[model samples]
Target: MGKLSFNRLKRYVNPEVFDFDTTEEIPPLEGIIGQDRAKKAMEFGIKIKQKGYNIFITGITGTGKTSFASSYIKKIARTEERPNDWVYVYNFEKPAQPIAIELPAGMGKQFKKDMEDFVEQLQRDIPKAFESDSYDMQKSEIIKKYQEKKSELMEELNTLAKSFGFVLKDTRTGIISIPVIEGRQISQEEFQQLDEETRKEIEKRAAEFEVKALQIWKEIQSIDKQARDEIKNLDNNIGLFAVGHLIEDLKGRYKVNESVLKYLESVKKDILENIGKRVNKLEEKVLEYFKRDIYLVDVEGERVGVVNGLAVINLGDYEFGKPSRITVTTYPGEEGVVNIERESKMSGRIHDKGVMILTGYLGSKFAKDFPLTLSARVVFEQSYEGVEGDSASSTELYALLSSLAEVSIKQGIAVTGSVNQFGEVQPVGGVTHKIEGFYKVCKEKGLTGEQGVIIPHQNVNNLVLTEEVIEAVKGGLFHIYSVKTIEEGIEILTGKSFEEIYDKVYRKLKYYYGLLSNKKEDKGDK
Candidate 1:
């Protein structure tokens, strides 16, 4: 318990068993490095293709997450075909709603042009067809025949009107028969001069002619309608002749694309009907925000009151663990363990509880012999978002103890785990992520073979890491130590036996107690 064995401190992966000089000699492992569980999970996620089954690649920053994800996704994308482009065109049936069409890439713009050209060509050619000599001659011949038949019918009607003592007259209303006397149309006064019997006879004859006149008018209307129908049919044929080729050409070009072909068919029908409508056509910045130059990596120097405490930084979608410098200062007061984070309202309830636990631990361990008269202030230096969880309880205690003992801790190693009143190191969450986080930082700062993380011994089972981290461990470039107690961690950090640090802290506290007792005695005498 006093001094930990080297094997117990670190579970080293001996490179000799691999029978290879370097990791390059070994085939690259599929998926993430040593994480067999995570690899299987990732494979399952890839095959499922369902919503809410996304794979979350979590670890420390600079752990090759971005690089690996990018390369892997790009490789898969290359094997698949490029997606077809979508185009939206105006809907003729429902003007407010537009229709969407899928076309081969780069074909949408051409389709828009073709539609515009079809409208423009129809506008130009339809007018020309109607004005052409051939079209005019055919239309004129049909009208001439209708006019001749109408003239013959009107002559028959006029002769019948004369036999009935009436004359056929063209007026604004229509062809009408007027009563005539002596060879001229009769005035209203002359008609009145006629006898009642004569008037009755005249009215009877005029009624008979009126029926015949109605028949002639019906015949003339039929002839006129027939002529108009012939002209309309000629016009439609000319229009189809003018633009049918243009539509057929578009259909042939996009025949292979079903969506495009359907869209073109609609266009053909619409153009023939409406004639003319309208249509129309990272990571570095992330590092800059969350990463501070001072907080990026661990330094390789010993300092009292300052310990590298591990923590997880959560950026919503991305969460990574990193080391924060936990610092402590002691003064002559009975304020107990003063958590500066709690004082500044930046510490969570759990973290405050952990700090209170520190007081309990110190009171039991060191204050049993003398009154605990020393005031210690513990702080998570340079932290802004506030501290949470008891994960760093062990770290804070290490910093507080180091301040009391005036012992310098190894700055290269970062510690994570919560310590109870009995000083037993308890497990914390995200142990795998925390270890990889420090490993990445150490790798960036240059691994000195001594740079490592101290995790709770219980969390050793959660060590699913990357291949690169495993390779580094195999080569002794980095390490991960699992400890069962604060005593074991203090020995690793200060490179001295825990008994030595305990003696130093005890002596300091005893001296402070003597000073406090003498001050109280002097005040009583006064």
Candidate 2:
């Protein structure tokens, strides 16, 4: 059929090519969910910072150290309207070197201003107590005088009643009269001297006066009670206002002195000592440079010192120059060593020096490995210099693998997990931060449709993505994926499903073992 002119004919319609930029939409912070513990810690730290305490968050790299710190600071800055300042420092490469940071020295001044404002507001609300209102004071004075007068009148009335051989008893209806002498006889001369009509008129008038006096006394008592109650209430209100004023005044007049400074000094000393002990222990365990055998002692020279696990000779108490080398002989079973060198490099001195050391180490490693063909470098980012545990091994391994593969792992995708020697991925710390770090990065990068992070499946319980991230995820700007194994991680990174790639790896492992099994079987048969 004339060579079947297939070249001239189009085989079929052109295959459709789907273009999806995996890095296009950075995952919203919302999609980077999980990590309640880390979120809670961050929130607490923010609250503490607002109350005037500097915060330090410690965790392994890829566990969200920087992300949580940054997020918390951002939240506080956004929500709180205060004059307090916020400062963020990150990318420290050397933890052993001091980091110099400056804080506001005017915090006391600002506090005073705040107190003044508070006092002004209180004074306005309670002007009567703060101001010398003469009306109130006068009312109190008049009430006191009336009470004294009422007491005197009552005493006089009681004395008159006793002279008349009558006892007066107080009753709710008023004072009642009772005869002290029961059925007592009266002198005829005294009875005759008082005309019957005149006597009857006098008794009636006396009884009426008594009734009027009792009514007057009750009225006085009522007025006195009312005045006293009012005075008591006013005193309480004024006293409370005075207390508020006193607090404000004290706040304004507060001054830090030598004693306070000394106490602070002691506190600083304690903190430094504790921090130093921790550093020493960590150095002993993880600092490779400290283990070099650099100093040795010679018995012939009567030396009695050791350095870097070697006994050192005093050399007549000489101060050696830079790059000095020392040699020493070992005891019978020990190997002899020589030519241990020292460098004269001096580090910077500052408060919080450890951060510098950590930063320098990480920075140097990063610098050396940048454009790395087959290597990766990592550090405990934003840790403020502390001993992070071994939970970051798997993340480190993945970073190394990504570097080696020359694959650009999206910054939006942070990972946290541990890895065994066999390369099995394991769970890790601060799952929240790991998620949030990538989420923040994504947010900063402008959310695209494809942004997300891969984390350990076991860390699902730890997910506590912030509200912003959650909202963004709901809006479809971000996503989060959980993985259990290295294979799954590889699939996520490579954009290929594990179902498609796992069989090849499984076959390879099986084939290698099968060959060994066949060789053993043949040997047994022979």
Candidate 3:
């Protein structure tokens, strides 16, 4: 537990050194840096192509899950058959149930355009087809044929009525029969002068003529119906002829895209059925909604009790990681480490536990010799939502230790790792992203060779970083340290050994213990 070797007390990251101003082009990232097992998992997920065996990537934030998945899937897609594209079309059978059609990649956009152009073209062709001289002449001929039959029916009825000594009359009140004598309508006086027998005969004969007139009207109604059916067929045939060429062209173009061919056929019917309706522009709106801005990294600065910790926020399908600034404040009291996050309900169970673990570590190390009485608060700055994870526990302890020892940690570097009461650093998730987030900030602010990150030694195998970060490290403009214990982190951040720091911290605690004791006794309090 004592007299540790200088080499054992520190494990330098030792990034590759190079001329700061070299113009050599750093190669593009061909693969993830240190995650071989994850790479294999990715391959297995992509190759199987089976149902219900979807891939679920599990790792701490900043471990490069999104980056790895996106790049790998994109690379795989280039060689594999592309996924089908989907489009929403208006359903005619069930208007509320919009139909979803799937087309091949790169064809959805074209199909959508073709539909729009079809809509515009329909507006021009439909009126011309309806207004053409041929269409009008054909329609007029049907009406004239029906009218000739109606005239012949009237003439037959009039001849039959004459034989019955009655007139077959057409009037606004409808068809009627009137008494006739010698090819002329009879006056009321003349009708009364006729004998009762003659009058009854004339009335019976007029009733027979009425029956014949009704049969003619029935035949006329049938002819009108036949003419309407013919006109409707003519209209539909003309419309289909105008649209068939446009649709068949698309069907031939996307013959390999089965879904697109079906969609085009549906579109053809829809364009004719709804000549007055507009085409949908849904893809444009979706693209506009998904357009977003990505923040690359965190800013660098030096302050006591403040350290940069990595965190991730998933915006549904899209995800990103940034650095969280953790800060701690301490004062004299009988209280222990006060977790502001826990008290305000801004932290999760694991995070609350991580802070408590630091208290245990502090008591076991220094309070064993004296009363560890102090009031301190630890908080994650600018954290608006509940934070979960012990990954930043080690960083929080570092910040607390800096505040207690009055040591200033470098702002250019960030850290991620969990710690225990034994002061051993444990592995954390998203080690790669945490390093890269801080690196971007440092790079933006100008990475002084000193800017880098400290991570747990066990987490080294989990790293998969971007090419820019790799090149920066190689050029000596950045670094990444892997520490196994808190002492190494302390030495790296403060440039002082744990023994040197503990010596000063122990003396300070003892002096405070005695001072508090004297005050308690003077006031006759426990």
* Candidate with the greatest lDDT versus the true structure: 1
Ten-residue segment with the worst summed lDDT in candidate 3?
A: 278-287
| Candidate 1 lDDT, 91-112, residue by residue in tens | 7678798888888777778888
Clashes of 2: 36
Q: Pick the candidate with the highest TM-score.
A: 1
- Give RMSD to native, each candidate: 46.3, 44.7, 43.5
TM-scores for all candidates?
Answer: 0.47, 0.26, 0.45
Give every collision pair in model 1. Answer: 33-467
List candidate 2 segments past 4 Å from native: 1-384, 496-526
Q: lDDT per prediction? A: 0.75, 0.43, 0.71
Cα displacement (angstroms), candidate 1, residue 200, comes to 99
Positional deviation of residue 12's Cα in model 3 after best superposition, in angstroms: 85
Which scores higher on TM-score, 1 or 2?
Answer: 1
Per-residue lDDT tens digits for candidate 2, residues 298-394, read: 1111111110011111111111111111112221111111111101111111111222232233233332423211111233321211222234444
lDDT of 2 at 4: 60
Clashes of each: 1, 36, 3
Question: Which has the higher lDDT value, candidate number 1 or candidate number 2?
Answer: 1
